[model samples]
Target: MLYDLNIAWSPSTSAAELERTLRFSAALGYNVVALNHTITPPVPPQVANPLPKFPPSPAGPASSSSTTPDQTPNKQPKLPTVLHRATLVLNDPSAYHRLPQLGSSYDVVAVRPTTEREFQGACLNLNLTDASLISLDLAQRFPFHFRPKPCMAAVNRGLRFEVCYAQGLSSSVPGDAANDARARAAFIGNVVELVRATRGRGIVISSGARGALALRAPADVVNLLALWGLGSEKGMEGLGVLPRGVVVNEGIKRSGFRGVVDIVGTAEREKGEREDKAVGKGKAAAGEAAKEKQEKGVDNNDKNGNGENKRKIGEEEDGGGGGPEGDDNKPMSKRQAKKMKAAIRKAQNAEAKTT
Candidate 1:
């Protein structure tokens, strides 16, 4: 499905206006669209720049009856899926600290760098950020240039560079023709530079359209991207695939554990698992200790039996209880007999002294 990843949505924009924009996007065959709320650094309190909340049903009427089989009365008109996303314009380095807080609430988070310093910070610090659209529309006012190192770094980190086509498309407003022409030129130049720097690897084409008139069909966007130096395959990927990747990665960042593991089971279930594991371990330990005690008792019994056997053998040999054979059996070795006689004499002498 085609995805238009950026559409300016703000607190100031009425629900009717947003509905009109989304209807047009759906009509143009975009399957998914991001409602972009742009926040400027040094955020003003008056502006309620909260993330867009998706409504249960689309703003307009449901699909009406049609003669075509696909559009029958029973069939429902499919409105483009809405996603809540935010774009932060970085004017100060310290302002970046607020992104994590804002990112948690939004489906997708993007950064627009207004200065060289901001651009560097975006590339370095926003490695985990969703996207950073080259603010080429602001090139007429700012002297920021797209550098390669940081751009490639961001690409390696799964951060994409957005090329917004809304401002670059032809404008017939008589007073704004010159400004629009300059914007188109700068946008084309900046986009070309980005494609070359990233080797056409991590670029996404988006409408960045505020209204229906600015939105284009997915085919038109793909063709426009092709004209801007990306291969046809890359163009298609920008519209259909890369934008989905942004949504997926941003979703992981929002819901997953430090973007590493997804949390699916409930807390109660997790606690139960831990308790079960502890109980099992305790049982195993108790069983092991009991087995060891049983084995130790058996060993002690064996040792006591061995001592009794030795005592019986000693009594038979020395206390006239008889040897293993017969009393008549004596040591054949003279030395053994002599040693036995000496031991007997020593015992007799001790008895006499005691008496």
Candidate 2:
């Protein structure tokens, strides 16, 4: 399924604007969209204990049980699933402590490291983060010549590198068209370097679109990635497979380990099965011990001058070792007889040594 994981949404945004953006995104074939809330840090002391509440879905709850008023008997399109996500802009490394708590509160937790120190901390120590965003549009941003070591390290830990395309399209440079053009150029340049550093392994191309106008078709986005130096297959994976993996992994991280295990029975039934297995093992072990004891006692009785249970040693000695043809005597091979004689002589020598 196609996903647009970053659509900036806030409480101040009008409901009408939110609805319009979602409808336009759905029209462009996006099956899932995340309503993103960007939190700039050096977090305020008065900030609520929990993060602000998530924004509502664009069109609210979908009525999938019955056809809509305009639907025909055969024609109906599926609605998109709305998810909540939050982006944290870290200005300092001290803000790392809050990520785990914040991550649990949202469907996806993304971090935008605006400085070199923050970037280093994110790659090396900030294991709680799910996505690493390069927010070059911000006043505070990392340098263009960042090393590949950190980016590749983040990829190794299942963190996806996000390149937001909407910022370049919506450049707000406070000057004439020439200034805006320059700003767009810088934005694209940063994106190219970010993609290069990650080597397109964990890259996710998201619109980061704030409105309906900012949103582009999925194909348009893929083409944009191609222009940014990623191959066609890698671009497609960034759009679909990579984002889906991030979402699935984030869900698994949130929901405990049982979500992955295949334990499907009532509590009482599981308990009963365990107890039954233990009882069967105990019975088999006891039977084996009893059989061994009976054999040992019979041997001891025969050795204690009781001839009733013991066979004649001379009759049993002529290459009469146990073989497949037990009841009938068969001629043994010369090699087999030789080996049996050696074994008997070795046993006699051992008995003589013990005496």
Candidate 3:
């Protein structure tokens, strides 16, 4: 499925606008989209997700049951699978101590590092914070260049770098053309450096669009990234594979065992146990049938009153007896008798010769 990991969201954003953007995204072929709420330092002690939940879109799995005739008439177009995401603006390392707590409140957790030190820390030390995406505002020129060591380090740790194309897109505001041009240039330059540093891997492209107007189709987004020096394959990956990985990784961090093992549900466990019991019973029945068949054969043989029958069965079992009556009265073979007669003749001749 196509994924857009970052769609700008805030308290000031109207529900109508968000819904419109989501619908537009779905129309553009994004199966899943995350609404990103940017949070700054000094996080509140009581972390709660403020993003409002919307009803499942008509195209969603639950839509068949959730939508009714009355609601269908007024229902809007289907929206993509919407997920709540929180992006912590990491200015100081100390500000991110409650990252795990924040993660519990959001479906996905990301970090936007402002300084070189913060960027490096986010890349190398993200495991401690339980953050998945390293979102950089590539529109602004950074003092430090994207180095391979730290970028690859993050990739190795299963972390993704987010490049928001919305930052480079021209705004609707008048007299902002110069700023837009500069931002676009900076975005292109930074993207080239990032693609180089990470060797075109572990990069996720997101719209980061605040409104419907800013979002682009998946194909357009891929082409845009490809023009920015990223390969077409990698660009497609950014929109699909990498972003999906981020969402899935964050989900595991919440629901799985230390993000390594997932606990199976009780129903699933019970089902497996039932299947095993069935197999065991089948094996037991087969074994019992074989044993009973062997015993029945023995009983049938025992039913015979004549001792001859028993003797015949024993001889068959013993691979044919020496004689029908008994082994003691069995006659010797012609070859054995011939050998015995030859020995006697040789002995007589020797005695006579010695005499």
Candidate 4:
């Protein structure tokens, strides 16, 4: 089953409490949902997430008086979904053994560790030491230990890896032609090298979306993959969805399931669009405020200059008009020279910053 991995990063989700979201995701096209441990365990019926999320579907027995079927703690989705034991599962000993057992019920298990040094140990425990892939962070601002050759050779020969470059904190598509090209180029260059160097190992695109409006549709990811020179077929293969991953429910209708997932994402997108408008409005207000402040400062300076001019006129009235002219050969007054130099420096700095 296909699953979104940024579940933990999204608006509200817990490894044990995300049953409803899983149900909805399964109801959509995904066979599984990725969970991150970095996000704290969500609070009660309400939780912390970037996006606003509905509760997980009911796992317990249905009650006639219940308002919705999503009131329970861990209702199983119609299909099998994977629970990634990344940061969360690794911390709790309870999850260490329990997560791997899902392999019996579903396909595509994940293995995460406490440290890079613990990789082998964790992999061995999860029975994935020689398993196929590794998920890497894309929005990482700092450098990471990024060698895949050793992992490729050691993990398994002819193993295919999925590169999950998700949009975590940043939601910007570059603004200009040059900037956009520069940004996309770096991303493509890195992945292309990995795909080429690693040979059998490749990449898969995931939303890594969470919070209020972080998700992008799987189909959108498919389109994004094509832009990177890989098609959906290759991406799915890399994601272990086609050949390696298994479906949890056998009799479910594939078409209907995928349809529901699309709808949920569409809803999330609609909300995001509205939220984006609100953010844009806030920015506009802030810009207007800044402009007003600048104008007021300029006006105040003008008033000060007027006062200075009036004081000079009063001095001339009090004392007889007496003047001494200096020749150009004399050194310029320090005050006059410094003022001119300051103006030039201000202009130069402004120009430099714009570029």
Best-matching candidate per TM-score = 3
Better of 1 and 4 by TM-score: 1
**Cα RMSD (Å) per model?**
9.8, 12.6, 7.0, 28.1
* Highest lDDT scorer: 3
Please write out the lDDT profile of model 2 over residues 72-157, one tens digit for every residue: 22232334666767678888777776766665567777888777788777777776434433333421234646579988987887
Give candidate 3 regions above 4 Å deviation: 57-75, 171-174, 266-284, 287-355
Runs of candidate 1 with Cα error greater than 4 angstroms are 44-52, 56-77, 127-142, 170-174, 264-355
lDDT accuracy of residue 246 in candidate 2: 70
TM-score of each: 0.64, 0.63, 0.77, 0.39
Q: Which pairs clash in model 2?
A: none
**Residue 161 in model 4: lDDT:** 38
Please list the C-alpha lDDT of all candidates, in the order they appear: 0.71, 0.68, 0.81, 0.46
lDDT of 3 at 261: 82
Q: Global lDDT for candidate 4?
A: 0.46
What tens-digit string does per-residue lDDT give for candidate 1 at 199-293? 89888888877778888877777788788788889998988888888777776666688776787775455888989999999999999999999
Tens digits of per-residue lDDT for model 3 on 52-74? 67656546432111223223234
Q: 287 in model 2: Cα distance from truth in Å?
A: 24
The whole-model C-alpha lDDT of candidate 3 against the native structure comes to 0.81
Model 2 weakest lDDT span, ten residues long: 63-72
Q: Of the pair 2 and 3, which is ahead by TM-score?
A: 3
**Candidate 4: tens digits of C-alpha lDDT, residues 1-355:** 4546445443345533454445555555765455543422221233222322233323322211123324443344462334432332233444444542333322233443434444434433433322233444433322323355555553353233344544422434534565445445556665655565554334544555443244455676666666656766776664445323322211111223531232223334588898999999999999999999999999999999999888655554443233233344444544445656798899999999999
